[model samples]
Target: MALFSFYNVRKPRQYNHTPIYWDPRKEALEERIRKNKRELGMEEPLEDYKPQIKGTFVEGTSHLKRSYNRGEDTRARKYKTFKFLLWLVVLGVIFWILFFK
Candidate 1:
């Protein structure tokens, strides 16, 4: 009848506390980088900061040009006269349904 019953167990208290300090602004940037590496004897090289490959990689070089200009051949001759008046009203409704009904 005692398989596991600490049913809400409670026994652990020994804090011996000691931790509360706060002084870092990265120790004033490591004392201004150790006073600029003891007055510049040489530690500066870190500036490529990277980011620059935008646009145009040259495959099919397009700035835009299909080239028919006279105002795109007058709007492609008014869309080929509105597609030849919609194929003359669908061939006059199939020649009035093959010669008038």
Candidate 2:
């Protein structure tokens, strides 16, 4: 038989509960709008004017796709060259520090 009960082991307590408070000024403004609508007895508001379009606007063409792909390839090549030059400079600095110092 066990000498002590395992239930006596203390459980971990939570430490991350942050309380949120409501703003009284926003609530008062919303209540005032509700009171105004009730006094005017308005079911729906007037619709705003919207501009109409005639034709569809095609954003991407075959030429645009080809140009975009070429730009991406040139960017990738430039990034690779920049990374290689950066590593070369770092290695040269390390070599100078080890040999000259």
Candidate 3:
């Protein structure tokens, strides 16, 4: 309402962006040329590419990691449940002593 417009709020400005065009065929052609040069000894081939495995610290250790995480979660959940039950018992005792005893 104009009558309730005590604070003036300005609209956010629009962003004008110009997108760049990518040619996949050109990229593949350049990649092939580089590979060919490396094979022909024109360009020394880069160090043997060993892809890093991000799933585990060591190869075939993902299962161990998963089990460790599962154990930690279960232990924490059990401790939390034990604490909650202990508090509930203490409160129940206090309530019984106050009202019935």
Best by TM-score: 3
Q: What overall lDDT, based on C-alpha atoms, would model 3 receive against the true structure?
A: 0.77
Which prediction has the highest lDDT against the true structure?
3
Clashes of 2: 0
Order the candidates by TM-score, highest first.
Answer: 3, 2, 1
- Residue 9 Cα positional deviation in candidate 3, in Å, after optimal superposition: 78
What tens-digit string does per-residue lDDT give for candidate 1 at 6-100? 77676799888775875689788998897788567565433422323232232234422232322345567679789999999999999999999
lDDT of 2 by residue, 1-101 (tens): 77778888866997996659888899999988977876686633323222222111212456445645566555776797899999999999999999999
Candidate 3, residue 54: Cα displacement in angstroms equals 14
Candidate 3 TM-score over all chains jointly: 0.30
Model 3: weakest 10-residue lDDT segment is: 48-57
RMSD of each: 19.9, 16.0, 9.5
Question: What are the Cα lDDT values of the candidates?
Answer: 0.64, 0.68, 0.77
| Model 3: residues with Cα > 4 Å off, grouped in runs | 1-72
Ranking by lDDT: 3, 2, 1
lDDT score of residue 94 within candidate 2:
100
